[model samples]
Target: MGEEQFKGVFVEEALEHLTLLENALMELEETPDNMELVDSAFRSMHTLKGSGAMFGFDVLSHFTHDIETVYDLVRSGSMKITQELIDLTFCAKDEILCMLRNDYDTIPEVQKKKDELTKEFKDLIERYRDGGNGATAKGTLKKPDGKSIPDEIIVKDIEAPRYTYRIRYRPCTSCFLRGTNPLLNIEELAGFGRASIVAHMDDIKFLDEYDPDACYAYWDIIVTTEKEIDAIKDVFAFEDESSEVKIEVIDVSGELDGGDQYKKLGEILLEKGDLTQDDLDSVLGLHKKLGELLVEKGVVNADIIEAALAEQVHIREEKKSQQTSVEETATIRVPADRLDTLVNLVGELVTVQAHLTQMAVKRIDYELLNVAEEVERLTCELRDNTMNIRMLPIGTTFDKFKRLVRDLSKELKKEIILATEGAQTELDKTVIEKLNDPLVHIIRNSIDHGVETPEQRKKVGKPPKGTITLSAIHSGSHVLIRVKDDGKGLDVEAIKNKAIERGLISANAELSDSEIFSFIFAPGFSTAKEVTSVSGRGVGMDVVKRGIESLRGSIGIESARGVGTTITVKLPLTLAIIDGLLVRAGAGSYVLPLTSVLECIAISKDEIDQNHGRELTMVRGQIIPYISLREHFFINSTEPVNQQIIICEVNARRVGVLVDQVIGEHQTVIKNLGGIYKNVETLSGATILGDGSVALILDVNRLVNLVEGVERDAVKRLGMASEMSVCE
Candidate 1:
C-alpha cells in the first residue's frame, strides 16, 4: 500500500484501539479489582502508542505513552485504579481521539487539550511516585485476593532482565515493491539495545544485471535488549510472512550456556538444519572453517551457511498457533455504500420479478408461471439475505449510553443507574445510526424529568439511586424500544391544565393519559418549572417526535402519577422493503404494513348510515374507531356498497381503516415520495405493484394521530359543544 493508504489503515486500527480503551476504562470503573480489564486497557494503550509512532503520529504516540504509563503502574499493582484515575483516563482517551482526528496536535484546540491532559497524567504519575516510600506511596498494593501487600514484599518499577539474541533478516526480493523499507526494520532493531550489524554482500548481482527494485542484501545482527521476544517480532511484524527473520536467544543475563564457551560453527549449522551429520563429519575432518567447507562441498548453499552462522531463534510454536487463530477469526471490511448499492439493486430485481409473475399469471402459461414462481422465491431469499447484512446488534449503541448516563448523572448531582435489556436485538444499520439522537433525547428526558433526585427518591420509599431501563425487543417485523424510568411520574392534572393554558386541548376535552402525555412532544411545550443546561428548553421531546416519525416509526408515552414514565418507540426492521396488505380506496391503491394488521371485517355505507354517520364500529362486541381513506385523503369517487374495515394496531390500540377492497399481501419495496410530499404525514412511502401501478404505503401510526388531531381541532373550533369519541 501507498503511504496514504497505510495511514488510513492506521487510523482505522487506532479507532478500534480507542474503543477498546474506552470500554475497558468504563468497566474498570465499575470493577476496579478486575485485573483482566486492566490488562486489556494496558495492551490497547501500548499498541496505540507503538502503532502511532510507527505511523508518524508522533504527538499522539507521545500522548498515548504518558497515559499508558499509568496503566502500566496499575498493571503492576503499584497504583490503585481510583475513580479519579478512571475519569482522567477517560479524558485522555477523548484527547487521543481528538488528536488523531486533527492530525496529531495540528489543531489549536486539540493541542490545548493534549497539553492539559498530559500535565494531569504527569501530575498523577508524580503524585503516586511521591505518595509513599515505595510502591505503597501512591496507593495500597493489593493482591489478586484483595489483601494489601507490604511495601517490602512488593517489587515495583524494577527493570526487567535483558537477553541477547542473534538475528538473521533476509528480505524477500520483491519486498521493496510491496512498499516495505528493510532499513526501517533494521533501524528499529538497533534501538532495542547495543548491537552489531553486518550486511552480507555475497548475494549482490553484477552491476549490469542488478535490479534496483529487488532486495538482495541480507543482515546478521546480535543485539541485547530488556524488551521481550514479542517486541523484536513486532519490529518485523508487517514482513513476517514475506521475509525470513530468525531470532534466537544467545545469552540471558550475560550467560552463554552458563559459561564463556560458545557453540561451534558446526554445531550452529547442524542445529539450524543446514548440514546433515554426514556432511558435518566430512567438514569437521577437513580442518577448514565449518561454514566455508560446507559450502565448498556443495552440501549447503553459501546463504544457508551464512544464515546458520547467525543461528537466530525461530518464533515459538505457540506464537504460530496464536497467529493461526487470529487468521481464522479475521474479517474483511467493506464500505457501507457498497452494501447500500447491493440492496438497491436487489429492490429493483424484486420489482422486475413481480412484473414477471404478473405477466405469467395473466398469460395462463403453467411452465412460465412455475419459472416465475421460482424467480419470486429466489428474489425473496436474496432480499432477506441482503437486509440481514445491514442488521447490527443494538448493543453497540447501548454502550454509548452508559457513558452518557454516567456523565449526566454526575453533572445533575443525581444518583441514577441505566439498565438495558435485549441489547442483542438487531436492526438495520441505517435505522440504528439514525436512532442515536432520538434515543438520547428519550434517555436525557428520563434522567432529567422522569427520574427524581437522591433525596426525593429516598422520601418516596424508594432507593436513593433511581433507574432508567432502556430495552428493545422484536415484535414481529418491527422492534419496540422502550425507555422506562422509576421516579416521579407525569402529573396528570398539571399536564391537563398546561395543555389547556397552551390551547393544546379544550378545558372540557376528556382524553386518555396517553394523549395527555403526547402533548409533551408538541413544539415549544415543557413541563419543567425552570430551565437548565440539560433540559427544560421545550425542544427535546419535539425533536424526538419528529426524529422517530422521520424514520417511519411511532412514539407513545405512558405515565402514572408518582410511578414514573415510559416512552415507547416502534420501528420497522428495515426501510428498504416491507410486507404490506395492499388495498384500494376509491381509485387509488394503498399498502398497510402487514405487521400492524390484525384482521379484516366487512362494512358498508348502510352500516355507517345506520350508525348516524359515526366513525365507530363494533368488532367482537368491542367498539373500535375507524378512518375512511376516501374521506381522509379527499379521493373523490363513488363509494362502494360493500367496503372493508381493516383492523390494525397503532401505539398499542386497535383502529379500523375503511377501504374499497382488500388485496392480498405484497412484497413491497418502498420508494420515497420525495420532498414534494414530505409534509404529507399519513403516507410513509410509495411502492410499485406487479402490473406497474404505484401503491402508497400508509403510515398507520401517523394516520391515527392525524385523525385524533382533526377531532381535537373540531372540538376547539366548536367551543367543546359537540364531543366526538372516535379515539380513546
Candidate 2:
C-alpha cells in the first residue's frame, strides 16, 4: 500500500532468492550435468536482477545482470557447469550480498573482483563451447540425445486473454543536472496505450521547502497495450541508462476485467458515491480512466483530485506484487530473531501447560482434567511444529566438504575421494550453524593428516585415491555423524609414548587401546613432527571436543593401524528439552541423560568393597568401577547403610554413580549456568524441574574419563603383578 512497505517486501524477497542461489551453486558442484540445478541458478539470478531494479538498487541490478548472462548459457545447455563456474558464482553471490547492504563504497575492490570472476566464468564457458563438445557441434545447444534445448521452458502453461503491464519509472536524483523532465518520458509512454500516472508522494518533501527542480516523485503506470513488449521498452530508450524502469506483463485472461485492481477501484468509487451504477457501467464500457469519466459526467464532486490520489496507491501495490512474484517462488524469508521468539513462546506454553496438568491431576476434577489433556495434546503438536520450522537438512553443510576436499587434495598432491551418505538427516538450525566449523576442521584433518599419499597407498596395495566417507543417521534420540578416512589409522602405542613424552601422562601409565587413542583429544597433544596450516598443531581436535560437549553431545574415535580412523559424534535431536533421570546428592538435584542410563541398583554396605582406596561394585559377576557423588562434590554425610548406584555408559564404558536418592524421570528444560560456573567440569548444563528446582546435568563422558584415568594410574603401580592379578 505504501512505498516503505513495498521496499520491505522487496528486501525479504531478495534474501530468499540469494539463499536459492547458494543452495543451487552447491548442488551444481556435485551434479555438474544436472539441467534442473542449472536452470534454477539462472532463474534466481534473473529474478534478483528484476527485483533489485524495482527497489532502487540500480548498481546491484546492473552487476547481477552480467552473472545472469553466464548462467543463462549454462541453463540453455550452451555451456557445461564446472567447478570453475560454481566457484565464480559463489564469488558473484558474495558480491550481490555486498550490493544488497549498500556497502559499495566501502568495497571499492568489489568491482575489480567481480570483473575478474566474470572473465573466468566467460573463459570456462567459451572453452566448453569451442572445445568441440557436443554443445558446440549442434550450433544450438542440445541435450544428450541431440534434442535442441529451448531458450525458455514453461513448466506450467495457462491461458489468459488480456495481459497487464506494470511500468515503474524512477528518475535519478541528478536528473535536473541534465535538464531532463522525467514526467515528459512518462507522458510519452502513456501515449502508446491507455495509461494512468500514480505519482508516489512517499519521497516527496514538504511543499514549501521542496526543490521544484529536484525530482521527488516516481510514477507507476498500468498500460494496456496490444503492441509487443519491445514497443514499451523503446518509449524510454533515451533515458533507460540514467533512470530505473521495470515492466512486468501479467496475463489476465480467465478473469472478468483483470483481478484486484479493477475490483478495488470499483469499491473505492462506489463507497465515495462518485457515480451511479448506470454511470459506472457506461464509463467502464467507454474504456476511459474511471475517475476522469466520473467527474466529466458530473456524477459526483472533485474528479482530478481523488483519482490521482487513489491511483498512486493502487499502482505502487501493483508494482510491488509483480516484483514479489519475480523474486520468491515457493518459500518466504523470515528473520531469525522472529523465529527464535516464536520458539521461546512455544517453550513457555509447554511449561505452563505442564503445571496445569499437574494441578488438574491433583484436584481430581474430571472437567478440568479433560481440558488439561487437550491442552497437553495441542502443546505437544505446537512444540513439534516449532521444532520442524527450525529443522534443516544436513545436506547443505555436507556439500561444503566437496570443495574442501578438492582444494586440500590438490595442495597436498594426494588423490582423495570424498563420499557422502545419509546427507538428508535433519538437525536443529542452531546445531547446523555451529556444526559447520567443526565439520570443516574434521574433514581437513582427514585430508591432511589421516589420508596417506598416493605413493604410500600404492605401496599398501590400495587404490591410489584414498577414500574418506562422511555419513549421518538418526540413532535413537540422537544423531550419529561419522567421518571415516581409509588410510593409516592411529598407532595406540605411539600415542601412549607421545603422551608420556609430553608429560601429559606418566611413563608408567598403563591404558587400554581406546583410552590411549582418546588422548589425542587432550589439549596440546600432538604427535606430528612439524606443524602445518592444514591441522596437526593439536589445536582443532580439542576445540571440536569442547564444541561437542557444549551441545551436550559426545565425541569418540575408533582406529586400527594401516586401516582407517572413524570419528563419531553423537548429538541430541533438539536442545530445547530432554528426558533426564534425576537424582539427589549433597542436598541438590542432578540429572543424567536418560539416553545414556543403563540401569540402577541398590547395594548394601556389604555389597560395596574397597580395594586400594577405590570402590567397586559386583553386579552380576561384573566388577563396575564406582564413584561416590557425595565425596566427589564434598558433601559431608555419613555413607548410608544402603546406598543407590546409578550405572551409566559413555562410549560403551560403564561406571557406577552413588547417589542419595533416585528422583525418577523428568522433562528437563536446559538452563545455562552463569559465567562464573562455565569452567566447572563434570557437568554439561543445568535444567529446571517441574518443582522449580535446578538439576545439574552430568557430563557422562568426562566422568568416565576421570574414572578410567584413575584405574590406569592404579594399574601402573602394580607393574610386576601376575596376569591373573592384573585382570582382578
Model 1 off-target regions past 4 Å?
A: 1-8, 102-107, 129-328, 720-728
- What are the Cα lDDT values of the candidates? 0.83, 0.75
lDDT of 2 by residue, 380-456 (tens): 88888998899888987887777678768979999887889999999998888888887887888888878999999
Model 2, C-alpha of 606: deviation from truth (Å): 4.9
> Which lDDT tens digits does candidate 1 get at residues 1-728?
79887788888899888888888887887799999898788778778888888988888888877677677677665678999899998888788777777455457877787788899987888766544333333343556676777533442335467677778899999998999999999999989876667677778899999999999988877777788899998998899477899988766654345233356667776665556788777667677787778778898777666554443322122234335776999888777889999998999999999999999989999999999999999998999999999999998898889889999999999998889999999999999999999999989988898888889988889999899999999988889999999979988888889889999976788998887887898888887899999988789898998889878788888888788888899999998888899999988999998988999999878998899878999998999999999899898888889999999987778999999999889999989899999899898899999899899999988899889988978867776454444332
In candidate 2 the C-alpha lDDT for residue 571 amounts to: 87
Task: Quote the positional error of residue 76 for candidate 2 in Å.
Answer: 5.9
C-alpha positional error of residue 2 in candidate 1 after TM-score superposition, expressed in Å: 5.5
What is the C-alpha local distance difference test score of candidate 1? 0.83
Whole-model lDDT, model 2: 0.75
Off by over 4 Å in 2: 1-37, 55-59, 73-87, 90-104, 107-112, 118-334, 357-378, 605-613, 637-639, 703-728
